[model samples]
Target chain A: MKSTEILNSLQVSLTIKRLCHQLIENHHNFSKSVLIGLQPNGIFLANRLKSNLEISIQDEVQTGSLDITFFRDDFRRKEKPLIPSVTNIDFSIENKKVILVDDVFFTGRTVRSALDAIMTFGRPLSVEFLTLIERRFVQNIPIKADYIGKSIDTIKEEKVSVLWKETNGKDQILLYSPT
Target chain B: MKELSTSHLLGIKDLTKNDIQIIFSTADSFKEVINRPIKKVPTLRDVTIANLFFENSTRTKLSFELAQKRLSADIINFSASSSSLNKGETLVDTANNILSMKVDMLIMRHPHSGAASFLANKTKTVIINAGDGTHEHPTQALLDTFSIREKLGSIKEKKVVLIGDIKHSRVALSNIFALQKLGAEVMVCGPTTLIPKYMSELGVKISHNIEKALKWCDVANMLRIQLERQQIQYFPSLREYTHQFQLNKTLLDKVDKPITILHPGPINRGVEITSEIADSEHSIILNQVENGVAVRMAIIYLLAGSINRV
Candidate 1:
């Protein structure tokens, strides 16, 4: 596969700082809002944003990790079994604004699943989407992100990957294509 | 740990230690999901599962149904009493008729041993043996071991005594197979008629004395006397059986250290176990019921997953 480093480590940090600032500009103290990180991949970006947001807002924002494995529309289409991760949201989301976070915004399927999943907790006052990379011109659902880190045009076969320091010992986003 | 090699979960004998570990961890995640405000997952929304019970059951059937619902799968429940089995239709015919509707999986409970295995071979759909005669209730055993591991933290080197009717109790048979495979020492304590001699060949010790068994073991898994499956009286009377093997607070106090108690309900209160012990802190009966849903979900999810991996 051929790959290009779209965002260097330093640029990634700056983009995250800017995203945190933009999040604070709208949500303020975030006392009425909670952040939910989509499981498996979104968790890395969610954790980084959650920790960074706390530093900017100077208050604790209830952050949780949710696994949409069971909620996916195509969950059982393939024979390969999907291993479900733990959905750890100990607090109630009733009447609070929820920000569903993920790494890449491609088909909008994960966000769709997250939307159905969040209802089990309680009815939220409102729900919003936040994604790190909004890959341009690819959406199977009528869904868009409220917070986006970067938008880039890409082909159908190309893959966008976000690496974090906590999990992969680096902070970068790469776009990979078939050689 | 290795994933289960077989797509169908007919019995504990088909699972390895690693398979149990994988199921336990998967159930652990499910347990977390059930505790959340939103108890449902969309994973099995595209799949349809049928719970086919040819035998009478309350807990297992409900548990499997609840697990299926939680996974957001389409569910159909069939029982012998409500179905056309009274018209003399064979089990295979009934199953194939249901499968013709495009059901993706079948969970069954029957009065004969290997009944699930028999159907598994006849159908391409995934078959899970909820309980099959005196053979093995794999899910119950999985939940039992899961409950034990959850309570005591581990089963390795732990002494578990299966008390009461062992001959006809499918739970006891499955538990023995699963626990032993996971490195736990197992013993059967009951009357001579109830505790078969061939059980010793399976590598489990036999004990007729309940007091000795309780004192020696770290966990006592009390089993009900299945009077329904008995053709003749296995024991003389219930009073005599209770006198010999009943577990109350007095028997529990006799042990030097506190031992965890497990009973796959509906409990024969005051017979195999007294009300005092069944409701005590040492008993994980309710926990077992709660884990039942999670374990069933794991089994269904994993089996469904195996189909695609192939």
Candidate 2:
């Protein structure tokens, strides 16, 4: 499939709307919950979720961003690594539930590192993962997302891409197979 | 590949080759930002940076403050004399209070060694060592290295002679580590009492006289004679020290090879170096001051972003 056509079929905005409804229904009892977005694209999605959730819940939600460049497990191979984005969660997460949001879930390494990076700040009551896309047969770790938009069966050599209107000038997901 | 997050920058010896390269490359980015029409960048906007200086400093403090402001970070200046510490509050208490204020980073200069490291352990905010009592000044060392690279093309195999008051100057100690790490041949020359005899243990050469040390050296770094050194009896008189250790026109004329002169300001002109030599063509003291802001901007930028992923 062409990149543009695959992206158009992804329906990220619709997936986000459905996920917000489900998250509110599941987490309604928690009063002091916060949402943390992984750096780059995850932060973009988290901000949208915060705005959408505010309309449904009638209360403000605290949002934070995390950069996992330094915390990555594989760091020896890259040349001139880019700086990570800002991580700004002002509230104490000690007893509050944290819903970690990201755009795509691949081998689960990013989410794994995010968990380790967040613990350095404070201990959250609990952390639940949410992602727009989940691929099949790629479980480097046993951890799974609590909220997944869609799970696609794919080969190991395929690449999954998420593009949003805020950053990439459109909302779409592209699956690229190695040549 | 990924960049390593160093917990603190306490000394040059603590940095690895990768760490030094990261610092230099980051400083290069800041150098580009400084040359633009609008010098400010939004990278550090809304980030609060605190400059806690327990020691008297004019130039270093000003350069740090300007660096933060140019990056659009909010700045809070706290001096020892007018601070709550003067009202009998402990250094830890003062630092805790500032950390309580939700400052993003703390750049400190104290009269005691390990003051910045102490603050780093007590708080979560990133701590930058501005200057600590005769211990190390990492940022100054970075700017000096940056200046040397800009002038000489490469620091590897270059000869650097650090002259005068080695024991009392933290800058000298920091330079010794920095130059050696960058592959420069470092030598310290001064009076026997002022120069630590065992500095050679750190892989540096020691010379009592400037004339022997200056031969074929690519750079001469003159350290200021701290006026307090006289009261402490490191030397008997300023006139005698100047006559013996000063870098003047006559000494510069005798050197067979062209050499760069460096001094961390504000200069004690006519004491360690003459006015004629300080303002001459070979002086990089002013370049060192100008690059001070860029080097510090790189440090604050990298450290602030190091916690998160882009």
Candidate 3:
């Protein structure tokens, strides 16, 4: 296996800051909008974005984590059972702008499932998605990221991994492929 | 990432501690889902489940049905009284007939022990035993233990006493298996005639005294006196049994330390426990019912996941 570094520690911090600024530009005070991080992989980036946004706007940012495990189309199709993460959106999302965040945007299945999962909380005004790493040309669904940190042209055999300082002891994004 | 070791939820005895923890954590997730503004998930929308109850039940039936609905699974309920069982159709025939309709899973409650096990061998669909004679009600035990862990923080090292008719109570047997597996000490306290002789052999202590039993434990689980299952008189009379074993406020007050109380209902209002005790802050009976849906959801969600094995 070959590993290629896509973004380094400095690049990750800058990209997150850039994403936060873009989010602030659109959502303004964020009172009418809530940032929801997809569970497991997306929560790390979500938490970082929340803290950064709060520091910039000098106000509380409503953020929650949503698990799409149960909502996934492959729920019972995998070789092993899909274990779910906690869905902790305590506040209702009724008619509020929802910015769904995740680490890597892959087959668009996660976003599709998230769309279904988020509806159970309540009907949102408009839902937009944000991702740090968007791999282009392989999306099986029509879903696309509204705010992207980086977009890379990739193939099916190669994998993009986003490592977090919060969980992985370092911040970086790496692309893996067979040599 | 974690699948149940077995595809079917037959009994607590067949589940490992990891399986129990998995179910508890999954139930915790479902617990949050059910409390949300819209109490539903689209997880099982593609799956279909048939609840086959060969015995009469109120709480278990409703709880299982509610859990199934919350998961958005297509559901069909079968009643023994209304079914072709009157013509002496075998349990397998009845199950196969239902499975023919492309039912993905089967949740059943039969009056005979090992009925789920028997059907599991005969069919390929996932099976969950709601209750099987005096054998085991796995989901009830899961919800009961879940409620205890919810109220007490943990089940480890907790002293839980099962009080009342142990011989005819499937909940008691499943509770003993589940509690002991999770590192909780269990004791059965009731009339000796109603308490089975096997209770002592199972490493569960037996006590004839309710006050001493209550005082000796951290949680007291009151089992309803099952009159329907009792063919012969297990004790002299209901009045005598109540006078001897019914738990009221006075009995609770004498215990010194407050012990959490659980009763798997259709609680006999005054026969096994008083209405005060049933409705008191010390009681988590309603929580047991509420958790039943979550736990059953976890059980069904875990078992119903993955159709290739079927």
Task: Calculate the i-RMS of every candidate, to one decimal place.
Answer: 3.4, 12.7, 2.1
lDDT of candidate 3? 0.93
Q: Model 2, range B223-259, lDDT digits (tens) per residue? A: 9877663447777788988988999989878976678
RMSD of 2: 14.5
lDDT of 1 by residue, B267-291 (tens): 9889999999899999999999999
Looking at candidate 3 chain B, the ten consecutive residues that score lowest on lDDT are: B301-310
Best by lDDT: 3
Candidate with maximal DockQ: 3
Off by over 4 Å in 1: B1-3, B306-310
Query: How far off is residue B286 in model 1, in Å?
Result: 1.1
> Model 2 Cα displacement at B72 (Å)?
1.0
By lDDT, the better pick of 1 and 2 is 1
Question: How would the docking of model 1 be graded?
Answer: medium
TM-score on alpha carbons, each prediction: 0.94, 0.66, 0.98
In the range A1-179, model 2's lDDT, one tens digit per residue, is 33323436347777888889988988883377889999877988898888888888888888888666545655323344455455566667787888999988888988988887677556788999998888877979888999998788777878788877887787888888766
What DockQ does every candidate get? Answer: 0.50, 0.04, 0.69
